[model samples]
Target: MDIAIVGGGAAGFMAAITARRTNPSCKVTIFERAQKVLAKVEVTGGGRCNLTNSFAAISDLKQAYPRGYKLMKRLMMTFNHEDAYRWFEEHGVPLVTQDDDCVFPKAQDSHAVIDCLVQQAADLGVMVCCKSRLMDIRSMQDGRLELIFDNGTQRIFHRAIITTGGSPKGNNLQYLARLGHKIVPPIPSLFTFSIRDKAFCNLMGTVVDPVVMTIPGTKFRSKGALLVTHWGMSGPATLKLSSHAARMLAEQDYKSPIAISWTGERSRQEVEENILAMQIANPRKQLATLHPFGLPSRLWVYILSKLGLEAAKPWAEIGRKTFNRMIETLVNDQYTIMGKSAFREEFVTCGGVSLESINSKTLESKVCPNLFFAGEVLDIDAITGGFNLQAAWTTGFIAGSCVAE
Candidate 1:
């Protein structure tokens, strides 16, 4: 049997290797568009290559995967994070889990991962054809699949797996769309919001943890450490919130109002009580001197300045109206999301080939036999951390395992 894997990425490599392993007599090949393969993997997670997540904090898969939770839940039965962790370690890459539950190679370099995949494929005799962009895919009458490359080369394969990852625009997936698969319009996910407020941007270096951010008139919300960037906010909370609200934010033209609770998951009443206790505990202390809720001093001062409150005033001098206003600001600080900026080198999109058109068990296209999909190309995406890569490994494993069947 001959198998072709298109787009040499995390999923493509994994699929190629798994296919060869599942049916050792089969010949497998990877066709990559770029001059080299695994380009994104080289720079992902700032070059450390976050392989998978421990998922210790995730009781529900939806918490990590904003989209495709149901499909992922089904796929996890065959290959989950634990399986990925074991696979990497058994393959000679030592792994470590950070405090945030993100797993990376102990070597602390993406090359460690790159080397592993390349070596594994080489050992498995998987043919890697770089600079081989697929322009079209057609089902052959003989039950084979024909892959037409940009270079005018055509190849017939018994099975094909599309692991092309996410494309920023719809046209990139046109070939797959021609095959009758439902294509979800691709939109950016896991990005940073661009805030136009110059004053807020001035707090670029400020980082607040355990803060809750919510989009108004929407059910999207995220809680984590938020770093104020020069242009806007970029951090776990912002990235997660962006993932959850990717479609809505895109519809709004990236212009939406966001509500943030400086006090984290604390209720408004709790914020009030905490403020009251702070005032009582430090009656004579200046408001500016004592920051509440373990908030950074600069952020607290910025909040006070925004409220037009005298920073030099003693805590005891706080009036009922001012206290209420303070409580409101602490729990409901508002900001407009003017635009979006890419989160470093990572470009993740939530939209792709909708899962409705694929078999959940094998990740094979329901419309086209012997054609399967894995990774970001399948309308599946997750927030920051290692969830995205986990999706890649699991889906790739499943597709390769069942592609020949």
Candidate 2:
């Protein structure tokens, strides 16, 4: 048996490795368009490589996988995060799971993961062809795949797997579209929002835990740690909101209204009661000196200044109207999303080959038999953390394993 895996990303490498491991007699090759392979893996998790997540806090798979929860749930039964964690450690790379459930190499380096894959592929005798771009794939009458390359070369394989990850534009997936697979029209996911408010931007470097961010007029909301940056917001909360509302934000041309609950999911009445209690207990304390809800002093002062209230004024001096404004701003602060900023080089998208067009069990294309896909190339994406990489591993393993069979 011969297998051809396109693209040399995390998924591609995983697929190649698994294919060869599953059938030692089968031939496997990875064709990477770029001069180097695993470039994104080297920089993922700020170069530490967040390979997988423990998924301890995710009661619902949808919480982590916004787009392909059902597909991922089915695939996870075969090769889940726990399997990935064990696979790495058994393969000679020790991994550490952070308190946030993000699993990283114990060496705190991406090369550990990269080197492991490279060495494993070498030991398995899987051929890797860098600078070999796959321009097209044609199905032969004998059920083999003809892979045309940019270098004016072609090869025939019994099976072909596309792990090209996510394309930034729709046209990039035209090759797959021509094969009768429905393209979902790729759109950016896991991005940060850009706010033009100078006052809000001044709160850069301030991080609030358990913030609830929501998009108005939509059922899109996410709660996690939010970090205020000089440009805008770039943290788990903002990224999760971006992932959930990726298409919506793109529809508005990245300009949308956002509401943030600095107090997490506290209700309006609850916030009001807390403020009232604070006023009664600390009447003599200056508003600036005694912030409610244990909010950062800088944030409290900024809120007070934005509300046009004197920070040095006693808490008892706050009028009813000012108190209401305080409650609103604290629990339901509003901001304008001027644009979006990609989350570093780890650019993720929520659309690709639609799952409806593929066989969920083997990841084989119903439209194109013997052709498979894995990783972000499908309509699978997740919020920040290690879910994205985990999807790559699970789907890649399934594709590789089934292709070998």
Using lDDT, give the best candidate's number: 1
As for candidate 2, its clashing pairs are: none
TM-score of each: 0.98, 0.98
Q: Write the per-residue lDDT of candidate 1 for residues 1-405, one digit (tens) a residue.
A: 999999899999989899999999999999999999999999999999988999999999999898899999999998999999999999999999999999999999999999999999999899999999999999999989999999999999998999999999899999889999999999999899999988888999899998999998878999999999999999899999999999999999999999999999998888898899999999999999999989999899999999998889999999999999999999999999999998866779989999999998889899999999999999999988989999999999999999855
Over the stretch 1-405, how does candidate 2's per-residue lDDT look in tens digits?
989999898899899999988888999999999999999999999999999999999999999988999999999999999999999999999999899889999999999999999999999999999999888889999999999999999899999999998888889888889999999999999899999999989999999998899988889999999999999998889998899889889999999999989899889999999999989999999999987777888888999999999889999999999999999999889999999998875689989999998999999999989999999999999988989999999999999999998
Q: What RMSD, rounded to one decimal, does every model reach?
A: 1.0, 1.1
**Model 2: how large is the Cα RMSD against the reference?**
1.1
Candidate 1 TM-score to native: 0.98
Residue 203 C-alpha lDDT in model 1:
91
